[model samples]
Target chain A: MKIELDNLTVSYQRHPAVHHVSGRFMAGEATAIFGPNGAGKSTLLKTIMGLCAPDSGRVRLEGVERQAIAYLPQQSEIDRSLPVAVLDLVSTGCWQRSSWFRRVDRAGMDAAWQALETVGLADFAHRPVSALSVGQFQRVLFARILTQNAQLILLDEPFNAVDARTTEDLLELVPRWRSEGRTVIAVLHNEEHVKQYFPQTLLLAREVIAWGNSAEVLTDDNLHRAVDTAAHWLERAPVCHVDGSAA
Target chain B: MTLALYDLVVSPFVEFGFMRRALIACLALALSSGPIGLFLVMRRMSLMGDAMSHAVLPGAAAGFMVAGLSLPAMSLGGFVAGVTVAVLAGLATRFTSLKEDASFAAFYLLSLSMGVLMVSRSGNNVDLMHLLFGSVLAVDDAALMLVAGVCSVTLVTLALIYRPLLLESLDPVFLRSVGSRGGLWHTVFLLLVVLNLVAGFQALGTLMAVGLMMLPAITARLWAANVGAMLAVACGVAFASGAGGLLLSYHLELPSGPSIILLAGLVYLVSLVVAPVGGALPRYIRARHRQL
Candidate 1:
């Protein structure tokens, strides 16, 4: 399903993290949200996921319910030290199928197992999540997303702190998801991975610096502008009152 | 020797009706509070549980002032007060700049002082002691029934909300993304905490009520590797501590509330040293083996 952002602005305490920017993510398009640190990439994703309310404007999901979207949040958000088994954690993705009180049926369990197998963590299913390394844990999270089997998938810095081998292994799943006609939006820092995998890119530095074709968005001039805009940001800048002027 | 062992343990529960009632009440508290406390410890809200126990005081005191030592009045009051404090803290955390722990601490301290003052103004020192420390041996049929009812409701509710509750604790953002309101589960959990604290205050008093909840949960963390195992271990510890504490109080003529809590505390300390999971002795042994 396509997601349309209509002049969205998300601010924390009056300082806008995501300025008024409008865009649409087409259905089945694998897009990389490429930006420097603090460029509102995560905030944009969160707003789209309806976790953060926009200060102005709105997010419109076309032909899909919010529940049909799968989100893989940053690792820091999860309590890895919790005494949860890998299988149990992965099975949580079947929550939509078996909401609240009902037990997950045989099919759901098999899906979870299949997900674990896909992530190469099948043996670690019964082990406590705390016992897994960070890379392994990320895989387990991916496994959970696989169980979710959502039409729209949002990944917020999914490859951070993961080993190169694990990163490559997980990165392969993006194209596979895209091929399956799932819309994949990912916040990523690695330019090579972006250029290699993603056909479309949104270069953001609080506002859209560039959008569309990855090669066009990742041009030297655009990349320099993104970094320069981010570096020269004023912390106490006045609120944007002029409509479309700031954009 | 066998007869002596029986006298030390089983006879107190078999012979005296009060002791029997006290044991049953404590078991009920243990049964419910163990799982609730496990979640508290899991969420790193063990101190929140303590704060909630103290927050129950002013309401129980208000009830006592109005209706004497009536079970229904005091429990209702305690439940109301505890829930009010919890909700206020939750709201403050949501709207204001104050963090959750700070808000809870502020509210509970205020509640504690107010409760102490109210109790002292209306009743004598002995009555105040009974309110603060509880009288497990003096538990009547109504009080026993309330505790049992709270326990049953708590278990059923926990079972109903178990998956969402776990998701809320472990990954709140993910829960929200998947269309579950984590705050709803959190509020429900807080309600359960208040309900348990109200029931516990009847038997263990406001001061020691959280002891049976927290101590067993913490002790279980030292021994168990997963949530289900942790829950089982916590309930087991709570049961053992409750029965042992009752026996200790009976044989030694100690106050029942402190006796129960102290016994739980003792178990916690012993578990800290010797539990197989993360306990000191096991870690030390593992370290030694690595070196060897």
Candidate 2:
């Protein structure tokens, strides 16, 4: 599915986190949102997922409903210490089909098991999430996303604390999802990983620094500009009144 | 020995109608409040139950002011007051700089002071004592009905919202991403908490109502491995405490509310040392085994 951000400006307490920026992610594309810390990368994804209301502008999905998108927020956002089994956590993805009240049927359970198998956590299905390591928990989360079967997937810093092997294992899923005609948007920190995997990249520092081919967007000049822009970000900056111009 | 056991345990409940009513009231409160308390512990809002119990005081006092010692009036007033505190605390957390626990603490303290002031200003210490420390032996038919009704509603509502509530507790962001309204379920959960606290206040009183809710749940958390097991254990603990406390009160002439809460506290303390899951003995054993 294709997604479009039209002049999106999201703010926290009237301070714009994502400034006026507009772009469209084409169908079945693998895109990485790369920027310095606090550059509104996660906020932009959240706005698209309808978790955050933008201060201005809007995010429009061209060919999918909101439920057709699955989001994996950063690991910090999830309470992994909760007393839930891996299989139970993954089975929640069937909520779209089961909604609120209906029990997850045999087929849904099978799907959850299949997702766990794919994520290599089949033996740990009954294990409580608190028993899993950071990487193992991330795999469990990805397994949940697999069960979601969404046309669009948004991942925020999916590999922050993951080890090398687990990172590579999860990295393999991005191309597979793209091949299966799904759009993947990830907020990434590693430039090498982005250049190697993602074909398109949006370099943002609260506003668009670059958008297009990954190699082009990750240029030395653009990278420097993103860091500089983020470093000099004023905490008490005045609200933007400009019409369709970068703040 | 058997005859003494029967006289100590079953005779009081069989002999006195008020004792029977009190036992049933305890059973009803345990049935509903146990599961709610489990959720509170799981949500790390154990103290929230205490705050809500205090918040119910002003409303119950108001009800008592309107109609002295009436079940319906007091319960309605308590429910309204508890919900208002919950909502006001929620709004303060959402809109203001105050965090949820801090806001809850502030609101509940204010409610407690207001309730105390109102009760002491108009009525004598006897009325205030009755409002604060409920008389389980005085649980009349109307009080019994109210407690039972609240229990029924709490159980049914909890069953209906069980899935969403679980998801909301464990992974709210995921629940929200899937397009479900986690906030709505959270509000509903809070409402159930207030309702259960209001029901509990009828027998345990405002001071000790949360004791029945939290102690059993905390004890259960130490013993149970999962949510289902925790809920079952909590209910069992609550009922056992209620029954044991009632029997103890019947024989010793102690206050029923304090007796019940003290029994639950004893259970919690015992569980803290002996429960297999995260108890002190288990951890110590594990450490010794590791050294070996």
Candidate 3:
């Protein structure tokens, strides 16, 4: 699916975290969003996922319903200490197919088992999430996203705090997803990983700094400019208007 | 032997009408509040449970003042007051700079003072004590019926919202991403807490109602490994403690409500020290082995 952001602005408590930004992520393409700290990459992803509304403007997904979109927030957002079985957590991905009150059918359970096997967590299916290591927990999360079977996947810092082996295993799925004509947008920090895996790149510092091929967008000049923009943006004061309209 | 067993264990319940009434009421509270307590502990909202119980005080006091110890009046008043504080506290957390726990504390304190003032202004000291402590032994048919009705409603509603509620409590961000409204489920869960606390207040009194919900659930957590098992263990502990507390009250001539709560406290302390997995005994043994 092709995703479009049109002059989207996200503000918290009247301070704009994401400035007026516009871009389009082509279908079947793997795109990476890079930014300095507090550059609003996560905020932009949240707005696109419909979890947070933009202060002004719109995010449009061409020809795909909102439910077809899957989101994997940062690992820190999940409460791993909860006493939830791995299989039970994975089965929740079928929330769209099953009603809230109904039991998971045999077919759904099989699908959850298959997802677990794919993530190399079949043995841990009955184990509580708290018993798993950080890497295993990340894989379990990926397994849940796989069960979502969404055409559009948005991941925020998917590799953060994960081990190299698990990262490689998860990275292998991204290109395969692209091969299947699925759209993947990820917020990433590692420049080398982005250049190796993602074909398209959007460098943002509260606004789009550069958008194009990974090799071109990752230029030393653009990286410096992104840092400069973030530094200056925080220092700049808000302009007061007589009519009191500022977003 | 059978006669001896019956006399030791079943005689109090079989022989005394008040004991029978207390047991039935205790069972109703256990079956309903136990699961709610499990949820509360799992969600790390045990303090919130205490705050809400205090918030329920004014409503029950007002009900007593107006209707003279009528069960429905007191329960309805408590429900309204608890729900109002829960909603306001939630909103304060969302809109203001205060955290949820802080907001709950502030609101409950205000609610508590207001309730105390209203009670003192209208009723006698004994009336205040009854509202504060409770009168579990003197449970009438009307009070028992109210507890039963609340339990039925709580079970049915929890069943309908079980999956979403579990998901919301464990991983709310994921639930929200999947198009399930986590906030609505949260509100519903809060509503259940309020309803259960209101039901508990009639027998345990507002002062000690949360003990029935929190202590047994925490005790169960020391033994059980999963959510379902924890809930079942909590109900068992609650019921067992209720019976034990009632027996202690009968034999020793102590007040019933405080006796029941104190028994639950003793059970929690025992579980903390001796439970096989997470308790102190195993940890101490492991330490000794390591030293050896």
Candidate 4:
């Protein structure tokens, strides 16, 4: 499915976290959103997932239902203290099909186990989520998202705090998903990482600096401009425009 | 000793109908409160239970003043009051700069004072005492019926929402992403809490009602690692304390409500020292083994 953001703006506590921006994510491609800290990379991704409302404009997903889009928030957002087992947590990915009224049957359980096997976490299936290492927990999250069988995946900093081996293991899944004709959009920090894996990049600093081919958009000048724009965003007054587009 | 045992433990319940009624009422509370309290503990809202208990007082007082110790009246009033405080505090945290804990504390304090004043103005010391520390042994048929009905509804509602509630409590963001309404589940869970509290206050009183809810969960945490195991252990502990407290009240001429809570407290204290998983002794032994 293709996603188009048309002049999207999201504000938190009356200050625009994601300013008026326009971009497009092509179908069946892996795209990375890279920016400096507080550049609203995650906010834009959230807006696409409909987790956050836009103060203006809208996100348009074509050729797919909203339910076909899956989201994987940062690992820190999970409450690990819950007594849920890894297997149970993963099985919840089938929630859209079974819903709360129907119990997860043998087939669903088998799929959950399969997802765990794919993530190399089959042995940890029955273990409490709290007992897993940070990397292992992230893998469990990936396993859950895999079971979602979604056409589009939105991830927020999936590699943060993850070890190199684990990161490599998880990175392999992105291409495998793209090969299967699924779109993956992720909020990533490492410029080198983005340059290596993602063909498309959206460079943002509370607004779009550049959006297109990774190599062209990730130039040093664009990165420097992104950082400068993000740093002084609060001091700049709103550029009021009758056309509903920021100058 | 056998005769003494019969006199101490068996005779009170076997011979007296009110004692049996009290035991039955407690058993119902235990069955429902154990699971409810487990969720509260897991959510780290232990103190919220305490605040909700205190907030129910003025409502119960108002009910008594208007209807004169009627079960339905007091329970309805208490449910409304508890839910109002919870909603108001929740709104305060969401809309204002105040934190949830601070808002709950502020609302409950105000509720406590209002309850005391309202009760003092309209009712006698006996009535106030009954609201503070319940008359479990004097549980009438109407009160018994109310408790049973609430327990049934609580158990059924909890079972129906168990999956969404678990997902919401553990991974709310994930729950939302999956198209589940976390807000609806949250409201349903809070309503369950209010229901259980309204039922419990009729028997355990406002001050000690949360004791039945919290003590069993605390004791269970020491011994049980999984959620299923924790709920089972908590229910077992709750029933044992209820039965033992009633027997003690019958033999030693003690207050039934205090007796039950104290027994539950004792079970919690003992579990802290001797429980198999997280107990002090087991932890000490594990540390020693690691050193070796």
| iRMS per model in Å | 1.0, 1.3, 1.4, 1.4
Looking at candidate 1, what is the lDDT of residue A187? Answer: 94
* Location of the lowest summed lDDT over 10 successive residues in candidate 3 chain B: B283-292
**Ten-residue segment with the worst summed lDDT in candidate 3 chain A?**
A238-247
Cα lDDT listed for each candidate: 0.90, 0.90, 0.87, 0.87
Q: Candidates 1 and 4: which is better by DockQ?
A: 1
Which clashing pairs does model 3 show? none
Give, for candidate 4 chain A, the lowest lDDT window spanning 10 residues: A238-247
Better of 1 and 2 by DockQ: 1
What DockQ does each candidate score versus the true complex, computed on alpha carbons?
Answer: 0.79, 0.71, 0.64, 0.67
Worst lDDT run of 10 residues, candidate 4 chain B, spans: B283-292
* Regions of candidate 1 where Cα sits further than 4 Å from its true position: A245-247, B287-292
Docking model 1 quality class = medium
What residue runs in model 4 are displaced by over 4 Å at the alpha carbon? A236-239, A242-247, B287-292
RMSD of 2: 1.9
lDDT of 1 by residue, B1-292 (tens): 9999988888988899999999899889989999999999999998898899899999999999999998899999999999989988899999999899999999999888999999989999988888889988989999999999999999999999998998889988888888988999999999999999999988989878899999999999999998899999889888888888888888888888888888889989998899999799988875534542
lDDT of 4 by residue, A1-247 (tens): 5699888889887678887887789789999999989999888878887888998889988887776677987655677877789999999988887798789878788889999999999988889998999999999989988988999998899999999999989999988998999998999988878888889999989888999899999998999999998998545666545344544
TM-score preference between candidates 2 and 3, better one: 2
